[model samples]
Target chain A: MNNSIMILIFIISTVAGYKLIKDVPSLLHTPLMSGMNAFSGITVVGAILTTASAAALHSKILGAIAIILAMINVVGGFYITDRMLGKFKSGLKDK
Target chain B: MELNIVNIVSLVIILICAADIKLMSSPKTALVGNRIGALSMLAAILFVLIYNDIITIPLLLVSLIIGAFIGILFTYKTGGVKIPQLVALFNGFGGGASLIVSFILLLEQGSNIDTFARFTAFSGAIVGGLTFSGSLIAAGKLEGIINQKPVTIKAHSMITSLLLIILLAIMIFGTVIDDYIVTFASGATVLSLLFGVIFAIRIGGADMPITISLLNSCSGLAASVCGFAVGDIILISLGAIVGASGLILTQIMCKAMNRSLWHILTGSTYRKVIDSSTETIVEIKSDGAKKEVHNYLEIVNKAKNIIIVPGYGMALSQAQEQVKLLFDYLIGKGKDVRFAIHPVAGRMPGHMNVLLAEVDIPYEYLCDIDTINPEFASTDVVIVVGACDVINPEAITAQGTPIYGMPILRVHEAKHVIVCNKDTKPGYSGVENSLYNKSNVTLLLGNAADTLAELISQLQNDLQSDTVLQD
Candidate 1:
């Protein structure tokens, strides 16, 4: 993707995400923040591609470390969010 | 862009994640939404491996396994109270990943890289570096490893401004003249880290929710810019989405506190030490402690409609379980009880809700401030558990105070008030609570858990004595 196209995608997705996330209740804001925090780990894709494409060993090593950190962020963020969301239960049977 | 397998797969995964966020609107579907998100992440990783034919890379597999193991271990051990710090730590990791990736790109591509990619990489490095360090400092504060009080060095504003100017110069000049790109990126990374520490260190405990949310946005912003450098749609779009979500949460927290984002970022958060000598001591004397407890119990027993307002101190003292027991006891006695949660109550947004939920308090009974404020007027009693600033009547009455004009729960509107706090001290904002001075207010100062325990026991003893008398 070219720079302009990439920038366009970013703008469109940001607007879409802002709209979608607005509907989330304040009750679930913590989990929502953690969930999005996990998604930020999508940088793992960059780490993987860059590491695989790099010619030098040091560059590859740095990419691998990035991959590790990003993966931890992804896994840990989702895990904690799920745990927290599971606890949000209503006592009343209906609604 | 041409339609290809990779593009199709990336689009599908992005949609899945979007649907996941959409499902989060309601808690009922949020669990499944989170699962779908994780699965989509898995799919994204798998696709990247197959598309690149790097599935056989031992280093990649090992790194992933190690990362997942550490992630699970940390998440498993982390309890509800530590969620804020854990999230901050994890956010730091994400930001660090972005910073490292951007640095790698700069080193490998050198001057040969296109100007746009170079610029994006530089921007990513700066944002990612700061996000990484800022988040770590925030986590430390939340974890109690670092002082929760704001620590501003001499000439803090001047130093911060100078650093900002230097970072801008490196970013702009490096893109134009790529010969010293590596040196510039390294310098920017170091300076950004320093700036982040300075920025975060000066923010006090009560302002954590805002700081965390902003750092969360920076992490995403870093990832998105790195995506532009690498020219990948998934990184760009998903990162942007995360970035926007964080920004929205930050705005919500700021508005809830009635403070501006700029004011918080510029280190205008409360640092005043309230002068206790001049302030009137409305707190009940120690000699009258027994009478105060008796008075609180009698009023609590007679109250039919009750509201509990919990704050960060409740979490600090691990009193939620005791609060839960109190809730159960009240419910058994047929009292209408609900929790009034301030938007900025705990260390993070929705933090109080999660803590209450952990103790099995029904989400239905937990009401936001706006929803519960008017009801306070009709309430028979308001029990404040380790909260101050949120319920401080001074927010409405006082001008020029740090908490002035801030939105607060109308605890004073209730007929009677009982505050179970550690002391009569002002809260994080350093503004004395005027509610404690009201005639209807009963200050039950001590550890919240202990105070609630004694209150429950007193109520129980009264019930036993009444039955004995009737028999």
Candidate 2:
């Protein structure tokens, strides 16, 4: 959780992600994007921490809104991605 | 030792996510991969709840349930044609969440917050606010709620630059001065949101793929910076991964269109709208047109191999079902049929494939431009359904046009070409489609759904009579 370690983790994860996504064919780019959208919702963790540690009522209310939004992002993104990937069927096998 | 335990657990979760992405590379395993990803998210949330001891927070639990319900409802109601808009909308939600978190941290941290945390909080606010507003505009445009054409006021570029400079100044002031963090941070947030509007307003619909990808990156970057503000490693690593994936997709879309990302972001490629009268409409079934359709029909009946090229126009007309019918009909007749999808064919990357798949067209029949380009020469007929720029020979032949040097499907190389489009007007680039003038091409201009239906019925009648005659 140190600043230097956080920066190091970011760099490593970014590079690994860049290499990993390169293998996904263009055929699934839309689903790939939506799935990443879900991951970005990891902000909900920060939202919870911020809300819990807040000293004032208004700040807690704002943090709760953030939690709701991020939850929507995580749940909706993954669910829709699953829906899309499910739709992709092999024609040869189906026949 | 407790911190080590936390770090080890976080690393395990990150590994799970990485494996999930690896599984997404193939269709067969992507469904399981997505489920695994959802599970990983759930685990991360539960881990945070237990570690932070926030499980007793009634408001958080209520909010989660409400958010989950809304999310599921929205996704369930969204049809295939509207997937891009839905993605953009949800992406905006993620950005907005980061912005709110950053705002809360900035306001509540007081004297104990370090300079690095304060700086990252400000940075997160800026990026998050911009992504939130920018993505909403993008979603609106995609949904037809806002003008799809670029809306530019006088000195648009100059105004955008001024807003950006102000936001940067406010961010710096909030970070360095610290005395008026509340006031300066609020100013920066508003200005950043304004900048998002200015940034997205001048981008036309055709440039949406790049804009969406770029905004996707900004949302992730925003979350990562928020993690830096809070010193959370899980948010940092996951956000970085999403950011990198978005950047890669942006680069791919830019390369496919032969446009630099900078030009797109700066709206350098945008020009004033041209007059609609300049578009030439070659009506269907005129004396000369009749003869061309007849020739195209004769060629289609005998053609052994066919490739169907679909564009955004196909989506606009909602003709995917009709296209499916044609595909089925052609395949039934023993013709080797394939669909050629240009990288930027629809509003986003791989949009055409998703649309085709929604109608039960198999993934095997969908081929990217690179894979289908070489086969066009040997193809007996190329059928263009509601597409223009991707198949326009002007992309390769003409110089100084907007589409010059951009990759096309090489539909012209086929022995015969049948174009079923709304009109002979130029595509999003406004460069004339030289393919329309080619000798071997036949234009059937109308609603793509109607034109395709006519083509199918014509083929059905012709082929049916031919079989009867042979019998």
Candidate 3:
């Protein structure tokens, strides 16, 4: 079982997935994004891993840099997202 | 053939991920469901690190759990980010992480130039860079911190097109630009990021969902590419899953607006006043229109069945209580009362419902278009309060109109239609309502609550006088 072959399969599927998504209609976006927001949150973990893994690795410099960027993505992502959702909350005054 | 506990654990984690797809339908539970799924995934990854004896790090697990708790707290605090902005931020985060991963692998692989690893490294970095910037723009728009109106850049399409061409040329012909190839890539990343901001801002509020979805797809593409760069199969598969789903949602949104994805993304949409004439409809003067209001009450009092259709204007004018008052008055005298609600009525979804709910209107009396539309024929008088677009007869009667196919309450289907609105002018799209011109429609010119309240007062006075005459 070559890891390279497995990686190629994953890449090919992702490209195909992109093509599949490109073909869908635009109306379902809000619902779809809402649904994916949960799953795509894997990035939250990716954020911790970026710095955590990098710091432990021999190249402390790269790991430290990765930590900073990952923190930005995590903190910024959560902050901005909450603000955006807030706009739709309560109710539209119908104006 | 030896299977380790890490392999067994990974299989369990994959199963958990597969089962988590069911949470998509009812997103109220998505946060909790995803956290559990994410935790399962983190644990599996942790197991991989430990089983291989790669390293023993307890802080990562603690931080991961803490991060999951913070995410849950966010859901409670802001009530979870709305779907579009949430997606945008998620895409950005995903892309940012993928970018970092690609960069790390590059440091390792750059030592051996011309290797497959280098190709993956570059691919991941570029895709992640694009996704990161694009997501930021999308997030900014949805968050309302940025203007919802599209930013009209000078020479917009031409600039983006030229940039893409130059980037393609640079990527293809490497020899001519030898000294600073990496620099060119870096420059392109900046340009893409800048363009991403401009591209997102170019889309107005009505179209934010589509842009966010497209960006979601981009982030997924970035992740898959990074998976390639770092040789990770699981990441690529999951990226494909997300990218496909996001694009499907994007396309659905385009169709709902009766548009193509390309036109929506590329074309500039604005609130244009299409050739409208206030003159052609025999514009009754305000006084003449006021006279018609008296006759309308007579018809309403005499009607056997009545359905009231309320909309945004009614809510804006705080007329829900007034309508509720009218409902009680009518029902007290033994007249039928019901309400028609459109699915996408007002400025947002279910807006009318929320307003009516506030007024303590029974849910049973309130019916969505599917159930209440056909019942309009049986209704004798349909009093539409501050509801223009939703009750517009043009939606059902005129095929040439922009709202032609769009579903609307069939208030006009009643024997008599009473339209109460502030402005004689058409609604947001400026489409002349056929209901306004119909002989059966008696236009009421005043604030919704004021008009309805006054009408009720007039009816009460007349009833008392008639009783006196009978005595």
Candidate 4:
């Protein structure tokens, strides 16, 4: 994608996101923060590509570390968020 | 030219993400909504992997396995009290990953990278580095490894401004300088990381929730810029969504505290003045001098209506389960019971609610400040379990105080207030709670879980004795 087009998409998506999250109650803010943290882990794509295609050893090492960190962010973030959200029950029986 | 299938799929995934976030607002569908969000992330990853055809299967599989294993183990092993720290750590990891990736991309492209790409990569590196180090400091503070009080040095703003100017100069002149791309990028990263530490350490423990939200937004902004550097549409869209939502959440948190974002960012919100008079009152309670021991069981037994206020200390002592038992016992005795939750009561947003929900407390019994504050005046008794600032009446009664104008639960309005904490020590704000000095408030000092357990057994024994007398 061209740079200008990408910037346009960024602005539009951000506005859409702001509208979507406007009504979230304070009770769910923790889960929302963690869930969004996981989504930002999309950097794993850049990590994988960089690591796999690196022509030098140092570059490869940096890429590997990046991949590990990104994966951790993605996996841990989503799982913890799920665990937190699962605790919220409408009735007492689920507990 | 025909549209690529991957682009279409990416658009669909972004739409799914938007819907998922919207559904997460309600408790009933929050779990499902979170799962769908995760699935959308997975789909985006797969799209990128297949479309780019960058298949180093062995390396990919190994990294994924190790990362997933560690992530799962850490998340499950961490207790509820440490969830805030864990979230902070994970957020830092995300930022660190983007920082590394952007730096590697920049090094590879060298001077051949376009101006726009270079700018995005540089911004990503700087923001990612700041978020990475800043969040680590936040986690350290929450974990008690670092001091919770704000640490400031003279002329800190001057130093920060100087660093900013140097970073901007490097970025602008990098293209003109021969083979200075690596040096300039590294310099920018280091300077930003230093700024992150300065920025985070200046905010006290009381403002951590808002700080965490801001850092979460920073990581999202960094990731989105990385997407621009790498030319990935899915990454760009997801990152933007996270960035924008996190910013909105930060604003909401600021409003909850009745503080401005600028006030928080400038690190001027934490007041250093300690009211000496309030300290003397706390000393009287803790030193057992003229200590009036009001029997909590006796008072609770006679009360027709009761309210329980839980806070971060409740989570610290793992008292929610015991609190639940007490709630059930009170209801069994035909007493009116409800929970009053302050919006910023816990370390993170909804911390107390999550703790109570874990122990099977029904959702309907939990009430926000607006809903439950009006009832406090008519309530027979208010039992505050490990909460301090939220119930501290100084927020309304005292002017020129740090917490003034911040809406509280109005626990002091009840006919009687029973405060349960380990000690009369000040709360996160480092100021003594003026509510403790009120004549109607009685102090019960002990671990929250232990005190609540004792209260429950006492109530049960009282009930059995009453039955014996009747028989």
Q: Give the top-scoring candidate (DockQ).
A: 1
lDDT of 1 at B32: 96
What DockQ, on C-alphas, does every prediction get? 0.85, 0.82, 0.19, 0.71
Better TM-score candidate (2, 4): 2
Tell me the spans in candidate 3 whose CA falls farther than 4 Å from its real position: A1-32, A44-95, B1-11, B26-74, B79-87, B107-127, B167-185, B271-471
Q: CAPRI band of model 2? A: high
lDDT of 1 by residue, B5-109 (tens): 888888889899999999999988999999999999999999999988998999888888888889999999988889999999999999999999999998889
- Candidate 4 at B156: error in angstroms? 3.0
* Predicted structure 1: lDDT: 0.90
TM-score of chain A of each: 0.94, 0.95, 0.43, 0.91
**Fnat of every candidate, listed in order:** 0.82, 0.81, 0.18, 0.76
- Candidate 2: tens digits of C-alpha lDDT, residues B380-399: 99999989888888888788
Report the CAPRI category for model 4: medium
In candidate 2, the residue pairs with backbone N, CA or C atoms under 3 Å apart (3 or more residues apart, or in different chains) clash, namely none
Q: What is the Cα-based TM-score of model 3?
A: 0.65
Indicate whether candidate 3 or candidate 4 has the larger lDDT: 4
- By TM-score, is 1 or 4 better? 1
**Interface root mean square deviation for model 2, in Å?**
1.1
The best candidate in terms of lDDT: 1
Score chain B of each candidate by TM-score.
0.95, 0.96, 0.65, 0.91
Displacement of residue B396 (Cα, Å) in model 1 is: 0.9
In candidate 4, what are the lDDT values of residues B1-471, reduced to their tens digit?
Answer: 126886788789889988899988888888999999888877776766677786546777688678778789889899777888999999999999999988888788857778877888888888899899999999999999999878888887777677778877766776456477998888878988898898888877768888899999998998999999888777788899889978997887787787899888777655555434335545734443334546656678889999999987898788988999989888888898999999888777777787887787877788888899999999988989998877888888778777788888989889888888888877765557877767677877899999888878887787677679989
Q: Give all candidates' CA lDDT scores.
A: 0.90, 0.89, 0.58, 0.83
